[model samples]
Target: MSVLIQYYNDFISRSADPRVKQWVFMDNPLPTLAIIAVYLLLVLKILPLYMKNRKPFNLTRIIRLYNIFQVVACILLIYMYLTAGWIQGEYSIGCAPVDWSNKPNALRMVGTFYWLYCLKGVELVETIFFALRKKFNQISGLHVYHHSSTFFLTWIGCKFVGGGMASVPSMLNSFIHVLMYTYYYMSSLGPEWQKKLRPWKPRLTICQMIQFTILIIHSLSAFHPECDIPKYFMLLYLPNLVLIFKMFYDFYKDSYKSKSASLNHHQREKKIS
Candidate 1:
């Protein structure tokens, strides 16, 4: 155990992106691990036990506020990435490697990556809310896995390569999240509003599917011998990307395709009658 710890500390000291090593939660994995540990303990044990005999809190206003904050944060992230280089054609879509320099734009990109990592940590609160409201159904394996893995994954990305190809996925994800959180915000208004937004739910899922597909392709582009951003990052990241994509695909089929098929069968029976 001591040997392993020594090796980890040495590896991080040598390989971490120097610009971000001094940033909050960027110095080591322990803080991030602690956050995840607390999140799991609360949602899986403490919150559930606390809410067992109590009435669920009506968090309509709180949810709406949180959704609004997510929307704004995503917008800011999009702006940060865009102005940094993505929109100005400064980055290669196929394979842009990290700058790793002290140039102003490069540092700005580092800041963007760090903030995105921080945002993932903040997102764990969504699960906390579900637990507090006794919405255990929302805390499915996919939900927990996605939240936990993404938080750790972003931390790794920021600590190593803070810019380049990574910014592409994070930026695109922010755009999709803006749309998603907007839907959540509108749906939180009331039951009638939720009914009105129902059609958009499947559409949102389609958008998520599209995002993951693009990410898979983009991640693979890094493997070209000349791309220069470590292939191992993609090796670690792509599998998780593929896994999450498959999960989302399953959800889409179960949630929408089956319902569509059933509805079509009902229509056919009505016609026969």
Candidate 2:
């Protein structure tokens, strides 16, 4: 394990952008890991106990505002990514690489990726909101891990590979969130609007699953020795994307497929009775 740790550190050091070396959390992941640990501890253990005997907070207005903010943030990111990296097809789907220099366009690309890292911190409020509402069921392992890992991995992206192909996943993720938070915003309006919007929910999950698939494919392509993207980053991303895809697939199966099957079974039984 220690040998592996040293190799991993060496890999990151080789790939990291020299320009951003001094940024917080850019030099190492230990600080980010510490923050995630505290957040998990609070949400999963301490806070739940504190809220156990207390009334759940009615945070509908707060949730609505958060959803709106997320939608706006995602939209802005999409625009920034377009202008910085992908507009006019500047970045090919599978082959954009880190711009190691400090030109203006390159700096825009780097800043956009770093901005995503910052947003991941804000997204932590998602878990906290669930906790505040006493919606413990929503705070699953998948939820916490997704929030935590994105923060860490994106930090790695911004710190090491901040241009070219680095922007792909962030752009895709922002696009997905635009749809996702719009749905959330509608649902927060109450069951009436939620019912009208219900049809879009599974579509959102499907989009998320597809987003993971695309990331896996794009990153996997970078593993070819000829690609300018670093081999180690692709190596790290491929497995991680596979894991996220599996998790989301399982979620879709349980949340949508299983529920549909159970509902059909109940309908058949009722007819028989």
Q: Please list the C-alpha lDDT of all candidates, in the order they appear.
A: 0.91, 0.85
Q: Residues 1-273, candidate 2, lDDT per residue (tens digit)?
A: 999999988876776788877877777788888888988998999889989999999998988898899999999988988898577566778776777888777888888887888899889888888888899999987898889988888888888788888788888899899889888988888889989998888889999998988787777778777888877777777888898889899999999999999999999999999
Please write out the lDDT profile of model 1 over residues 1-273, one tens digit for every residue.
999999988887777898887898888889999999888888888999999999888888999999999999999999998888776777978789898999878889989999999999999999988987889998988889899999999999999989998999999999999999999999988899999999999999999989999999888888888879877678889999999999988988998999999999999999999
lDDT of 1: 0.91
Model 2: residue 26 alpha-carbon error in angstroms: 2.2
lDDT of 1 at 156: 95
Best by TM-score: 1
